[model samples]
Target: SVSVLSYAVIFAASTKLDITRKDSIKFICTFAILELVIELLYISYYERKKMISLLKGEK
Candidate 1:
């Protein structure tokens, strides 16, 4: 829901600011990739202990 609202705000701002399509695509794609990388890092960091235990075949 936050992501959707962010995208909606970006779209609205782009239209109001008269940004070009190519620039908008580039900006949105970059934002999305950055968000995904951050999310993955957050998950990996928090799950590291569980993952290590699983790799050692623990119950």
Candidate 2:
């Protein structure tokens, strides 16, 4: 949602901001990659915590 809003704002202001199509694509792609990386880190952390809890239960 935020990404879309930002994209919309960038596009709406593109003419005034003198932003090129290539730059806009790059910005959107960067945001997507960063979001994916963050999501993966969170998932990894949750899985590790779950495994630790399971191991503790086996004691």
Model 1 over residues 1-59: C-alpha lDDT tens digits?
Answer: 99999988887788777789888888888989999999999999869978888999986
Question: Model 2: runs farther than 4 Å from truth?
Answer: 1-16
CA shift of 38, model 1, Å: 0.4
Tell me how far the alpha carbon of residue 26 in candidate 2 is from the true structure, in angstroms, after superposition. 0.3
- Report the number of the highest-lDDT candidate: 1
lDDT of 1 at 44: 93
- Give lDDT: candidate 1, residue 37: 100
Q: Write the per-residue lDDT of candidate 2 for residues 1-59, one digit (tens) a residue.
A: 88779767756665466678788778767877887899999999999999999989942
Estimate TM-scores for all models.
0.73, 0.71
Q: Which ranges of candidate 1 are over 4 A from the true structure?
A: 49-59
